[model samples]
Target: MMLSGLDHLLAAGLVVAVPLCGSWSQRVLERATAEGRPDARMRDYHLTMLTLWSLAGLTLLLWGSAGRPGSLLGLMFSDGMRVLIGAGATVLALLVLVSQWHGISRLDDAGREQLAAQVGSVLQLLPQTSREYRTFQALAVTAGICEEVLYRGFLLWYAAVFFGVWPAVILTALVFGVAHLYQGVAGVVKSAVVGLLFGALYAATDSLLWPILIHTAVDLQAGAIGWALRGARRGAV
Candidate 1:
């Protein structure tokens, strides 16, 4: 195969580490919430951001060491179609932002609590304060960049060496979903489906630009939804 032994080892390690870290972080957040720790969510956000960035750095280092073209990692828009798709994705993201802001701006007290209760399983991980929400926004952006790079770009490329392109796409998507193991079974399923969509997007467009934009927008929308719901819950107390 084209992959070195070192590459295999690193890939295996990451597959284990990502889900383990996610599950552990969720547990920590739950415990902190139970204990009434004010900074629990913010701390979790910070740690997660650091972890994602670090992993992304490792992927970049490996790419460079292999003397691979950066373009291989979906770093550039090399065609008019890619550029058009990127522009369309950007516009879609802007629309999503506007929609989320509008929805949050219109939530009444009951509506907020009702909406917040919908995400009850992981509510504790959501931001309850303005500062936490701000930090979460940053975390969301970081995740969009790092996750797309690591999963769709690097992991897909690496997996394709053994599995071929289409199989690699599916495998990377499953891995991406599993990495959200902290979300539990249903969450894992949902995330996996989303991951599949992202993988397909990458495969179709042959670039990460639009996928990154769409991913960031999805996270930003989720954060806004959580903040709206949490704000209501906090007020109710």
Candidate 2:
């Protein structure tokens, strides 16, 4: 699809805007922390959900206004073989998530400490209470749907206007990674790798459904693991 000048402008705005928002949020978080505000992270969660959903809604609007079919965003169902492939990939991902959860649950104190150190950069945003965990769950679901739409669907299409499909996939994946810069270098690397996986999945399946499911599963699993580890550390203390 040949995107118009307006479309390019919108895409550029989004590419610049998301990371800037993230950086701004990080500053807000730091300031809140310095001020000893207890509700800072919760507020951050709410704002993040709002931003992601808004961006996703705008993307849909832009696509519709451009007379683009939903299929172009990988919203339509594929053939039987594609469905089977998506299903198989989803099941495999679920199995892997389950295994990872099991391994995390069995972490010794030392192991937990090591893991904690690795994730310390983003610990401020992680859930500590049941209510926060529930909120995080909602965030996970929102991110899974909205992010796939904005990044995998919209950004991929936009980038493909300049780059070919495969290069667009890679470029979008890198941009997705940059979107999580607040998580630190390790987080950026890890998120980028996951983005590549999701981008590849969307490319291969020609449907966004599988990537959305897997992305949600991954986020949910991460939240559960973080919550469990935090609880374990508290009990240990």
Candidate 3:
């Protein structure tokens, strides 16, 4: 479907807005963590993410409804090699999660402490209690779904209206990376590379299913790890 001029304007606005909003949010998170307000940080971070991403997802849904009602579902659940590829990626992500958990579990108290400190800034955004872990899980899943819908699904579709497929894919991947700028240079680079892989997968299958699965798995794994690390620190204390 061809994007209208208004659609193009909205897409352009999002492309610029998302990264700027992310950078600003990251600063807020960093400040909260540095100030020893982990609980507040966790609450605010999840709330903000859930609200913004929900709006984004709703916007995509509305757009899809107006033009191609079932297109989003088709992109997600169509049976094909793409589905197989997405499933395989999910398996790989799970394996990586398991490996990281196992490695962390093997660490001594001092090692674990050091590791926790190393990523303390990120970890500080996690829930401090087991109950809060459920909330974190919801947040992670929301992130996976909403982000894929906005970045991979909507953005790619919009870009493809103007640019060729490959160009759109590259542009989308770059923006995806830029959105994670708060993660620092290495994080941005890593996210960009991952984005490239996701873009390629989407191009291959024309589905957001695999990328969403992989992204959700990765986020949940990170949340689990952070929760575990927090528990370990509490135990040590």
Candidate 4:
């Protein structure tokens, strides 16, 4: 209710977009399965299409926020500020990854293989996989940009504008927790905890760049850990 201006617009875009995009993807996957061939390439194509449309949606959102031709609302913070956030994000990501790589409690050999196989399903190993990979890469990048802008960037602004700094931070974190409901129970719990953590970081720092960078690093680190465990299992075999 307190949200207004560009802050409101961004928060609204996120609240609307993710679920719509995900649901569209579910439909596409269902169609691919029903078609009988169900090639990975086909799935990849759908993902590409999905990403393109998402990009398009993002453009519209940006344009709407701009409300003027050839000139738009500039980022909430300075470029210098963004660079610092980016630096913090890099540090946070490395810290989390290295910690998890060495410290993430691993499953046994069987579990490693199972995890590997699960990763393989989304591997995109074929000719089309590369494109699909790029699509997903873009999707990840977009997520990093939009989610941070929306949640930590805009939402933080709203909370501070309507409430005080401390309440704003707490409320933003609460929204962060609620935002992950689509991730399922475990995901929801994890995301909520992490969301609040990230939210707090943003509030303290007042930059989305750091959160975006950290988010990407976290994903990559998790991916690497899974890859390492898989490699170890293969070596065992």
Candidate 5:
């Protein structure tokens, strides 16, 4: 389906808006944490994302209706086999990553320190308390849903309207990586790689569900680990 000029304009607006919003959100998080209000910051961050993605989803639905009714749902749930395969692959990947955490002690001192530093960098964003951890889990789920909807479902579809599918996928993945600039270079690279995988899953299944499940699982595990580390550090102090 070709996008009208108006649709293109709207798509361009979203492409610009999303990254800017991400940068703004990072700043908000930093400011809130500096003020000793991480929980409040997280709540605000989740609320903002929920609202932003909800509007993006609605806009995409309305735009997509010009092509076919229920096409949006079809796009998000096309192939069960593909979804299953994607889910299985993601689970295996998660298991490997988690297992590595347990084997950190087997690494040399330099490797262990490097791994710890990487994990510590990520844990900075994790909630430090049980109450906050529950909220963090919800945030992870929300991120999985909303981010896939915006980046994969909405942005990819819009990009495909202009560029071809492969071009759109690469462009969308690059943007996804850039959105993680706050996470540093390694984070950006990791995010882009994961984004590429998620894009492949979406392309394979023609469905958002598979990517959403994978993204949520990965985020949940990271959050859990970060929370545990934070608690341990506090106990030691």
Candidate 6:
């Protein structure tokens, strides 16, 4: 209920970044609009109008984690485990890149069509999502940014700082897995795996920059594909 100075400081640091990241995302939209992208629908959420609120709550969580019995955060920062986890991540990513490459090169016409049908089937299972108006878009953007900082920045950092690199990675993955509890077991498992992948990337790269870059590229591709498909379906219908 009552937070001390360090708690306040950490919370302030984390919360402060949320708004900064959120605003930065909004500015990205503005810049895109300037270039004639004009995604009016994706620019309306007020809470996410280039800022968000999340400090006290996250601070408390981090503070609690600091005193926890086990801390993967602690482990991640250790001398040996850090390198091991980091190296593991890099190797996995390279393999993934290769697999993706092979997949693309190996697909034929019928294979592509069958893959398309499978993708369509999977899309049918996605929750009936709606378009985020320009307003919600900003908020969604804020959520994306803040959520990343909250989980990766603070939580993951905490685990690595307190636990051990390996422990931190595993603990963070568990936390990440739980975060997807709403998505069911499959979602949880997938998210957990992704969290591990991201954590490993962070460990290997020693910079959030690469993971963030990779995330941006992956998201952009997915977004573009979705947009193209939607437009094509609309035209056909």
RMSD per model, one decimal: 2.1, 1.9, 3.0, 6.3, 3.7, 10.0
Winning model by TM-score? 2
The local lDDT score (0 to 100) that residue 26 gets in candidate 2 is 94
Residue 5 CA displacement from its true place in model 1, Å: 2.8
> Once all C-alphas are superposed, what RMSD does model 6 give against the true structure?
10.0
Query: lDDT for each of the candidates?
Result: 0.83, 0.85, 0.73, 0.55, 0.70, 0.49
Candidate 6 lDDT: 0.49
lDDT of 3: 0.73
Per-residue CA lDDT of model 6 for 1-237, tens digit only, reads 233566546544443543355446545654654575534325424433333344424543665665732232222233466656555655665566557655744666565455444445222212112553223333434544454455565556655655667777677676766654444466568768877877666656455544544444343333333333443333332
Question: For residue 229, what is the lDDT in candidate 1?
Answer: 79
Error of 3 at 159 (Å): 1.7
Q: After superposition, how far is residue 15 of candidate 6 from its true place, in Å?
A: 16
lDDT comparison, 1 vs 5, better candidate: 1
Q: Rank the candidates by TM-score, best first.
A: 2, 1, 3, 5, 4, 6
Report the Cα lDDT for residue 175, model 6. 70
Query: Regarding lDDT, does 3 or 4 come out ahead?
Result: 3
| Candidate maximizing lDDT | 2
Residue 49, candidate 5: Cα error in Å is 3.6
Compute the lDDT of residue 175 as modeled in candidate 1: 93
Estimated TM-score per prediction? Answer: 0.90, 0.93, 0.83, 0.60, 0.79, 0.47
Worst 10 residues of 6 by lDDT: 120-129
Please list the residue runs of candidate 2 whose C-alpha ends up more than 4 Å from where it truly belongs after superposition: 232-237
- For residues 1-237, write the lDDT of model 4, one tens digit per residue: 333465565566555665565546545554664474437444644564466456545654655665633212224343566557656666866776777666445567766666655544333222223344454455555556656655665556556777876677677766665564443455456666777777766655555566777776665554445445545434543
